[model samples]
Target: MTDAPLPVRRALISVSDKTGIVPFATFLAGLGVELVSTGGTARALREAGLAVRDVAELSGFPEILDGRVKTLVPQVHGGLLARRDDPHHMAALSAHGIGPIDLLAVNLYPFEATVAEGRGFDDCVENIDIGGPALIRAAAKNHDFVAVLTAPAHLAEVRQALMQHGGTTLALRRRLAAEAYARTAAYDAAIARWFSSANEVAFPPRVAFAGSLVQTLRYGENPHQAAAFYRTDGRAGVATAEQVQGKELSYNNIADTDAAYECVSEFDAPAIVIVKHANPCGVAVAGTLAEAWDAALRCDPVSAFGGIVAANRALDEAAAEKIAAIFTEVVIAPDATAAARAVFARKKNLRLLLAGALPDPAQPGLAYRSVSGGFLAQTRDAGRVDAASLRVVTKRAPTEAELADLVFAFRVAKHVKSNAIVYAKNRATVGIGAGQMSRVDSARIAAWKSAEAAKAAGLAEPLAKGSVVASDAFFPFADGLISAAEAGATAVIQPGGSMRDAEVITAADERGLAMVFTSMRHFRH
Candidate 1:
């Protein structure tokens, strides 16, 4: 019996990234392990002065069909699938003169990157490496005996273990195997999604995307319910869905945070949005985050209680201090300064999230909605509205400043629930009403919220009637317009696709309200 454990005597390595290949191959050679590679990997190892066997030589077949046929033959897979304990497996390997592969290092081609570059379908299809995925899956499935490395970052850990133990441990093999399977799964999902887009038809029979839960919240929309946060693989938004500080996220906390983030993401300037009950109670843009917070807070001081606040700019000491004065449930920003972090330390129950920026709106993905018996699927509403697209249907056209605020309000309203009405003045929401069965009721709720905030803030009066109003969708009747006008709204904006558009426009005109039709519906259902 030798003191050394069973070493990785035979290894097959293929990779798109060649980083650390020379040193890794040299280390393997020193261990008396036979290195087998294909194409560029073989050339690289050979140039590094290591004796590497080509896959063709081991398989006894040439790579045919423009390199697509490499590493798919029985000899390549047979070496990986053979069992060390079973006599039949051993006999089959011996009869075929094939050596068992103890280690496989493979990474798939850059299919996502290639497609992202606006490559044609043919280019994307060619970039899909079939052999690489097969090798990875085979090695991962037989991980009890074989070590499979899919990510280059794992090279150091795997190499150290191999050097120390003279063989990969079962634990390391299993961990690497999990990563290998994950890599292949994500790769195939990307391919399916791409094919679906290219062919204009659903791929994989039914479209499904996978996301791992980053955290389980304390509760759902209510404390009695349950909720969890999931981070989609390869998604760049929301700081990878992390909780940097404060208490555990509640069900309502996550929903409000999402609402706040969506509102703040609409503006390019320094902005702040305060959300309560999945609706924006206050939203504002200013020269600095502190100023924006002050303006947003001024929108609805009372309703801002226990609300979620999100800012586009870094949270500074001044802004954090202002936010701390109120009873806020959460505060999120791209980053928080050291002084800002210090302020939050006092508010132990306030959840702090630092998501750097918004996600790109054009990315393709699925949107899910749960129903009574099943779930519904549709594409995300990533559409945007431009100010120039607005048509002033009223006699009095909206001014430039009003137009800007209208656009801002429209975008914020899009994220609010149905029958949504957002009251914005100077890029700040003075009031918001959402989730009401009647559009007029939503408007009244928003107005009432603004009035309550004004009283709490000791302002002589709330925002004047000239403040803009944004509706998530078209108003079915003029009642909503009349309610907004009575509440001091001077300009209104909404998607003009409703059958009663003329009636709503007539109501706005009767009140001397400047109304614009965006021709874009933003119904959040």
Candidate 2:
């Protein structure tokens, strides 16, 4: 085969992540590809003794405006955007001392990391590089003639292609261009989201967001449909969801996973939350994961079957063995031990997810719901109901232990579909009522489930008529309180923003029930 003409003569390299940069740049240099770098990258390359030219030198202008105007000039962009097939473009570039830039290795500044550190808004805004994004976009838009590299992860592949072909291939250029565009898109989305959230502005009229698929599920809700999970920048939330191991997540699996993750993320201690069909079947906190799993299992054994379980701590061997005895659909935790992995080996079909630390609760994200016309958008419910924000409205106040369970029940109930009610004796949920048309019906379902669980566990009384109850929303009428009171809920916790809050308080008082007002409503549709 005859030698192919080199497509890439000049290259501009700028990056925030410097991993493998030296080796990649060295390889490009050996191929006689001119290297132009900016700021820290230029310093690092020169210190490594590689023949490197500063971006300012190639652009024929000093980096003005505090280094923000380095690569935005025509000298840099003309090289990247010039069409190799056009003689006029080549003539213009030759006259202007601009050579066709075949390879553009560039990554933007760490805007996301700066914002995540809780830095001032001005600091984050300053970290957004203008010239970096411009160069990336220019190179990506002209992928037919230019190669773009955005991620350090692609360094090895690009090096191999360059070494094997004596230059990067057109196919590789196209692939890297796609990735470069995706990187800038996601970066822009993050900036938009951060600004909107900080300013409390509604979604922009023209909002564009992008994320990568984390995994494809076995099916969506049912075996016939399709589904997948996507994560953005490996952050928290449903979009940032990660599946450590399992058969495949379904539509219902994703829904339940969201519910399970939300509930468990609220607790700071070692806790277990068991979710079935987007409702918490059981939840518990203890000194150890094993104890937490046992207490949660004892809450509603029957409902826990094939349910999604989420824990706040690492899964231990004892907890894994206990969980293996039941037919669980999924089990998630921060981490798992080797012994725990061995125990779970017995239940090969059960999904095991190792989610690291939960995402920051304050970060904002869009909540999407499918509607008849198109879709409805709203802000995700990232609010937390803390004990300090609650008030005891009833004549009696809940004891400390009861208060702990009450708080746990409230958090669990928030993720359950409305009309929702949750019952808990210890930290574990005994029964849950969800997606009912009537609050009274939800209360009844929760009470009955708890009773059944108690009986199966051979306890004389499951809830023992003193278990706490949590309502996701305010009691619109006193009848719901009456229902929970009759169902043996000794204490009730709910958001007290309703107009008829006095009536609900009266009903609780009449039934000798302790009621606390959270001043916040958690309505999951």
Candidate 3:
């Protein structure tokens, strides 16, 4: 059976944001409902010529301790929690000289905004609302009897419901109650995350996560799953990127674009990364953005179809022309030239995003994954190693050019899913193998991909010929080491930690392969 509307006898209003409080309270007053409020809300309502009863008067206790002890009094909660249908509860409320509160319009203090502004710790502590959350929980718990309104956006809807049903329907109360609880939960999460960050706690006693919904996508990784996009409180990446052109970004497009953008941020020079299915198919750095785009495309032209491209620098007309030739899904960069924008106009379906400068890979943050019953959180993978940190484990030291290529491959390996193998020549990835179960299989797949890519390009030799290889983790056996050597890889870089490390190093020595030990792994799952 459908729920009947509940009549409103009185409402308590308090809000940090006074966007539409007066008009709402006036409407409630017009319905012969008494208006009760505190602090700024009472002042605003009374200034608007509405007869408002102060909470200090209702509780018969003035707000004390800098206005912290106002609404915690029993008079406020007793009225909200009492069920009108229960004769004993009504008698108890009447005996205490307390009137029922049928509606609550309250919004919390701007705690997240205050923290975002770089305020001091004391300022943030003060902005944490005490009475607000208490009031919201009380009203939400008694949702069957009291209507709770948490946001200013809900004001119009509540007004419409009131006007149509002559009060708030049970359905409306339940919906608003759910929204209220979500608001308080997110608020608490933000506060918890802030404390964890401020205290430099890697694994807090309790993990807290929060985000605001930016958009509701058409679907998720597949066509059937529902999905939405949310931006974190402080960080700005692809989620905050501004779309200047094209159709709406799909779930895959957003995911792939983020992968492409993050990969490009690893390079100091002008670079471009092309991603397909959340994996990097092509990555290259060159003197100019146009050259980078061309070099990256040469890595895997067949797999570049409808791929997402991200450039570290601003996109120019020359790069735009090259990207427009292909049926690409999206182009993300700091900005686009006027001529480049004109070129993209022809491909209106292509998405163009301006994400400003690349995000700092060293920034500390959490990476979360949801399991069946709980979620997992870990620090982001921001490890970096350079030539100075390289330790040559084998007898042969890598030549300077091979060292550059080894570092390049290692950086690309960091973005690929493990077990990962990357073959790079110069500053461009020649071949990539990712997400294989065994490391040896990944090595074989990389060589095979290199051969296929060479054949498709109508080249005489494989792209990985004379290229350097980078393994995301240690080579568990000598077979993986021999596979890279067999594919014409002259040098290899890996985290040297395995039970058969000596055997692998001996194989590299026999093959005359130069190997460097980073002693650091980059595993993405």
TM-score of each: 0.82, 0.86, 0.90
Q: Rate the local accuracy (lDDT) of all candidates.
A: 0.83, 0.82, 0.91
Error of 1 at 340 (Å): 6.1
Which candidate ranks first by lDDT, i.e. highest?
3
Model 1 lDDT per residue over 1-525, tens place: 222345798899999888887788788889898999999999988888889899999988999998889899889899998878789998999998988999998888888789878899889989998999999999988877888888777778879998788788888888889888887887887788888888788434766565555788777766688778776644544535456788887777776787788668778889888888887778889898889988888887777888999888788999999999988888888789999999998988888888765655556667778899877887778788888788999988998888998998998888888888999998888888889998989999988887787787777776635689999888888888898988888899998888988888888878888999988888786
lDDT of 3 by residue, 279-360 (tens): 8999999999889888788888888999999998889999999999999999998888899989998998999998877877
Clash count for candidate 2 is 2
Q: What is the lDDT of candidate 1?
A: 0.83
* Candidate 2 lDDT, 238-320, residue by residue in tens: 44545566677677877787678778878888888888888787788888888988888887787788898887777899889
Q: What lDDT would candidate 2 get against the real structure?
A: 0.82
Ten-residue segment with the worst summed lDDT in candidate 1? 233-242
TM-score (C-alpha, index-matched) for candidate 3: 0.90
Error of 1 at 16 (Å): 2.3
- Candidate 2 regions exceeding 4 Å error are 1-6, 46-49, 56-59, 163-171, 197-208, 216-219, 223-225, 233-254, 345-349, 359-404, 460-464, 477-479, 496-510
Better of 1 and 3 by lDDT: 3
For candidate 2, the per-residue lDDT at 24 reads 85
Error of 1 at 329 (Å): 5.4
- After TM-score superposition, what is the CA distance of residue 113 in candidate 1 from its true location, in Å? 2.7
Superior candidate under lDDT, 2 versus 3: 3
